[model samples]
Target: MTEGGRRTAEPLPTEMELLADLSRLYKIQPATALWRAVEIREVLKAGLPTGRGLDLGCGDGALTGMILRYAGERPELDGLDYDHGEVRVAERRGVYRRTFCSGSEDMPLEDSSVDFVFSNSVLEHLTHLDATIAECARIIRPGGNLIATVPAPAFQTLLKAQGRTGAAREAYVTTMNARLAHKNYLDAAGWAALLSKHGFAGCSATPYFNRAQVERWEKLSAMTAGVLQKLGATNALLYRMQRLTRSDDRSAGGLLETNRGIARWSRHWARIVAGGVLDNPGTDDRYGCLLVSARKP
Candidate 1:
């Protein structure tokens, strides 16, 4: 239930840099920015193993692009995702040397061709963990690593603990889990044992986003998005305004860019203020997410 040891490869990004990176998400989806930006800090702290690597289950590739911006070293990066639409968006971002739209059970890569594999918050949705882990082990050279993040059991526990009973409680839990098609919610030890069965040893899981923060994210995301959508601003004026706030020249690549912006300046300001709360890196065993990594030996 412990947070993992601090990685010493390089100092983590400053609070200022975090806010700036977060600003990008804030403009896009003000409600979720707090949680997501904080997660980005964890990814930065973990620091990718240096060498050619694959970003398994890469979505729009935005997070991987952000990771590269801070990670002083550049590795040959390839990406794979089951969603072809997201694969197209990832390609436009230019974060991956190549992008493939393929299922996790079967990757379109030569066996033993990769140095490492990384994924962020993507494994829990898949039903075939064993097949996917085997595919990862098959493609990665011996001694390489598989690093990913998923909802810990505490995530579901926290959801259920929110005080409902009977069919109402079951419906709530089912609805939430259904959104992600979550097939697993294992603790670190459970994850370690699962990985060991598939030949991935030395597994470790570090918890992040304690209960208070998780609750905050859940509440704020629904509140903000719901309010905006009701007002019909999510896809109209708000969307246009968010586009204008972009500091970069690249075009916004996905449906989310047009569909998810929170137009109100108040939400943006609130996010900057919440940065402090989200960045605390609190110590709590009942965490919302777990960052898990294991070696294929």
Candidate 2:
């Protein structure tokens, strides 16, 4: 990953291209998807006061914009990412008041300065889980919130199992071995324990999935792994299966509704078993991600 104050020769994709591709693939207007992410942030911080917030690993600042929108008034918001290219894109978009190119393993922020620290689909990519958690604890004020989401381990394991190649297998295995590597999926107990170790309290994990989305993914998975395999499209099959099984954070209803909140909570606990916990509890046949929320004490 590129560090702050450094430039690289690798040409980065234009923000417009990225947004257009994402919009086309997700079947939604780019602006609508962007605003929805903000709405989710508002729901996550429902009880907290509108104050200064930090977005850790804020890729392209989409979530940063969401945070500002959800706050109603433009509360002080800063975004940080390890990729200098992404930081540059965020700056160009004017989504964040301040965008820093820094890794989550080592955030350059003052202690107890921010009221809330939010991350989405970012903890999975860190190379230093403990250090990142410690940094979060160090930067957040007392009683401040830390909201994050990560792919569930079971989902990642399934993806690895579907990959069919020596190199692809190796890459998958490497990711699985490192807790801070790609798609670092942690169980409920593990997340709670990490929060406690880092001076956080009331740590909880909520599982999220969309019935309609999962159903569509299941169909896609069958076509890729089943039909495509017979057609001698090994690489294409793997690609489709991987894409079908990959984590989608937005599918979990974004914001919880009264009737659906209980089901989502149950699914979150189910992920504990999926993450390698011995005791198999809760009932959610297919879980893709988990949301963890805690408070600095």
Candidate 3:
């Protein structure tokens, strides 16, 4: 165990493995798919003369690479994560100019040093979320932007309702919370409040959840698996069942619809399955995630 009392039995993986895993999961070319709609490109296009940025919780440095490529000048980029194995992997991939093993609440970089700070699906994992937000405020130069995404609370609560009882429920909660230290799913109002408390200016958020898209994906995966099963494909059945079971499988009637109805108004279902869901456009009513952008005041 390390000094923090957490187990250290597993060493961090090299960057190659991290890239390989992401490539498989996203089912697209690396670098391209990972940063596609998160707007890292557009944000960089605005141009930071200083060419310095930080990628917090940069799992495998996928975003880190995109940031570097977008900057186009080999700007001073840093990537940090609590997992040393993942950091090592990033280092091996040549993704970040500098890579370190660090946590959200305790970044190693100096305060007010970076021109920009970006995190994708990262902030929610922090146990000390407020402290980390304060740290993000501190480290970013005045007027620098902090762009991030967080799971919408309504969808999470809906998942919880379906999760009802047993180990499955416990596992669901544990996984959701672990993803971003998501103490609770933050609605737009909740997110704006957090940003304002941290002295962030002009805080804006976009809802990105799509219940219909998620339902479609689930249905398609199920159908594909069924077809394979009919052809005597045992592995296909197992895979399809795994996906279906993992999805929020509660019927769309009674209590579940009521929960979804609440979710609709709160805009708590925006998600980043691969990247931003720009192809599907509708009001915030259908979104399940929140993409929040703010600046240090």
lDDT of each: 0.73, 0.56, 0.56
Question: How does each model score on TM-score?
Answer: 0.80, 0.58, 0.59
RMSD of every prediction: 5.2, 14.6, 15.5
- In terms of lDDT, model 1 sits at 0.73
- The list of candidate 1 runs beyond 4 A from truth reads 1-10, 14-19, 26-28, 160-163, 224-267, 270-276
Model 1 residue 169 lDDT? 80
Candidate 3 runs further than 4 Å off: 1-50, 66-75, 157-182, 216-278, 282-284
lDDT tens digits, residue span 1-297, model 1:
112233345567753456566666556555456666667677777778878899999976877887787775667899999976568778977999999999999999999999999988788888888799889989989999988878888877666334778888887677566543687888898888888988888898878878767776666655655456556654445555444444342454323333344335533565454644565756665888888899988
Q: Itemize residue pairs with steric clashes in candidate 2.
A: 38-66, 207-268
Among all candidates shown, the one with the greatest TM-score: 1
Query: What does candidate 2 score on TM?
Result: 0.58
Q: Model 3 over residues 1-297: C-alpha lDDT tens digits?
A: 231112234333322323233333233222222223333333343333345878788866655564454343455678888976567667766767888898888788898989877776777656788988898898999978887766677555434224357777777556534422466567778878998999998887766545543333333333444345446757534433332321122221123223445334223222333333334454436555666778786
Clashing pairs in 1: none
- Model 2, span 46-91: residue lDDT tens: 4223478888887667545533442334556788988765676677
- Give me the candidate number with maximum lDDT: 1
